[model samples]
Target: MLLRMPGVYRPQGDTRLLCAAFHDANLPPGGTVLDIGTGTGAVALTAARAGAASVTAVDIARRAVVTARANAWLSGLNVEVRQGDALTIAAGRRFDIVLANPPYVPSVVDVDARGPARAWEGGCDGRAVLDRLCAAARDLLTPGGTLLMVHSALCGTEESLIALRGLGLKAAVVSRAREPFGPVMRGRADALVRAGLLEPGDIDEELVVIRADRAITDH
Candidate 1:
């Protein structure tokens, strides 16, 4: 069981889906891994247990850093949990595998309140954090390295692909699943409908796992 501090994002469907995809990725063994927006270090622990030579997790919330470090300790896994902006922590570092499950829930405002909601509330278009991550994917990975990310389809999968590809990485959607609206999404249904992000009767949203690989030929 993972110890979750209040306000830290709990592992849910998106987490499960991302873990599943990671298991199937068949990445090179003993690689260095980076987990951005790590919550309880669930995904980071997976990498550590999978024999990654090193696993580093970054989160903007101090509570998340504490929670993830606690989880890693409890699980006897080696995960370096840091509290900071993902891009800032990743500067000048390259990992053989990069994993992300950033905030992708479109919200009326940039963020609801600043506490727990920051974990899920994406800006108006839901690309605020996702866009930045996609933009940095190529730089975060070593040549021929892979990036695995999960986000709601409401965030525009095509846009993410285009961003990664434009950066010279081969990108594609590797997995897709339909999930019922959660409490947040359910509550925002009306506003989302008005914003044309959802249909009147649409009660479910699709989650997509996108995998982008840096070309071996790229310097």
Candidate 2:
């Protein structure tokens, strides 16, 4: 799957999460898993391959949903891919583990400008999407369930911790990559700087990846 989709970014494909989910962590054999923003369904499929009993891959973009479903079928993995915004999706659904590689790019570009692709934009300072996801994640996770998210380091680790705390989740940096901002992000940063939404020096490569978990307290 990674070989076929070289352009799309899949955080679950990251060595850290893959290694941890498969080799490091104690994922119960055949447990259920959820992959938020399941681009190409790499993570969800991988989880299924790793013995997850059920995997649901959700994405906001119709194209992403189609691509993910196609990939799942080609891989012969039983993954359910659906098109829905994470923020407005129905509640009462919970999972043993939830994985998200949301758009963490902070920019001033209006989300409507990019249409459906805006699902990957993190707004100015890059925490807009992250903030919303964290809030919603609290209700989606089962007790003792894990929530893994990949985010930019430039957004401030402390800030992310704070946000997670607000949602009753604990956050920690799971991996760091000095990745270059993509073309769309580069242009957005420049425009935002010109518009005074960001400082010129604030634009640069950033460390990306924050894997978090929701605590489970027994009664």
Candidate 3:
């Protein structure tokens, strides 16, 4: 088990799904990895154990940063855990691999969510954070590098794929699973329906792992 702070996003179906897909992709060994929105640093640790030469984890929450750092130390792994906006922290850096389990639950409250809700409440159609990541992914990865991101299909897997492709990254859905509404999703089901993201009574949600690779052939 890993250390978990009160407000950090916990590892669940989506987390395991991303890790599994990433492993199956067989990313090149001894490469650098960047884990954005890394709550407990689970993905970062996974990358390290997968033979990545280096792993950098970033989270916006202070508690999450502490939790991830503690977990990394406890696991006796070397992970550079940073507390800041992922984009800001990763500026001018490129990695051979990128992993993310971004918040995608549609939220009715507002686009700018806070506290633990910040962990899962995505604005409106639930792409607030996801969209930014897709836009930045191309710049964050080295040529031939792969980005593995997991999120609810309710947030629009096609949108993510399209966004990445628009940035010249080759993108596709590499893995998918149907998961029941978790606490946050269940709590915001009505909001999602109102936002036209879900139909009435849609209890089961589809989670997808999107893979986008910067083509090595590109200049």
Candidate 4:
């Protein structure tokens, strides 16, 4: 079991989807890994258990860092948990595999707002963090590297594919699962419907796992 602190994102369907996708990923022996927005280090621990050479998990929440670190210790997995912005922490480093399960729930809440909501609130369009991660994927990855990311279809899976392909990477959705709205999405259902992002009475969201790969010949 993983240890999650208050305010840290709980390991839900999206997290499970990402973990399952990671299992099917082409992780070379001794490949290095970076897990962005890792909450309880669940995905990071999975990589480590699979024998990744190194696993570094980053989250903006201090509580998450603590929780992840503790979980790593509890599980006897070697994961370097860091508390900082994902982009900033990933700067100057490249990994063979990048795993991301960032916030994708659209909301009027400020992306910078503090508190538990930060774990799932993804700004007005739900693309705030998604866009940033896509834009930075190339820089964070080594040539031939692959990124496995999970988010709600409400966040525009097509947009993510376009962004990665535009950056010269091969991108596609590799997994998907529909799930009933959780508390957060249930609360935003009306607003999303009013904004035309969702149909009236819609109470389910599709979670998708996208895989993007850098061509080995690129560099």
Report the lDDT tens digits of candidate 4 across residue range 1-219: 677777888898999999999999968999999999999899999999999999999998889999999999999888999988989988999999999999888985334557777788888889989999999999899999999999999889999999999999999999999988998888768888887799998879999999999999888
Give per-residue CA lDDT, model 2, range 1-219, as digits (tens): 343344444443243443454334456666778777777777777788788889888887676777788888888889988888754563678777777777776666666525445556776777877778777877877767777776666556677777777777776676666565566657677776776555686645555455566677811
Q: Provide the lDDT at 98 for model 2.
A: 78
What TM-score would candidate 2 get against the native? Answer: 0.80
Question: What TM-score fits each model?
Answer: 0.97, 0.80, 0.95, 0.97
- Model 3 C-alpha lDDT per residue in residues 99-211, reported as the tens digit of each score: 98888887775545877777887777789999999999989999899999999888888999999999999999999999988776777678778878789999989999999
**What local distance difference test score does each model get?**
0.91, 0.68, 0.88, 0.91
Clashes of 3: 0
By lDDT, the better pick of 3 and 4 is 4
Candidate 1 is scored at a TM of 0.97
Please list the residue runs of candidate 3 whose C-alpha ends up more than 4 Å from where it truly belongs after superposition: 110-112
Worst 10 residues of 4 by lDDT: 108-117
Off by over 4 Å in 2: 2-23, 110-112, 189-204
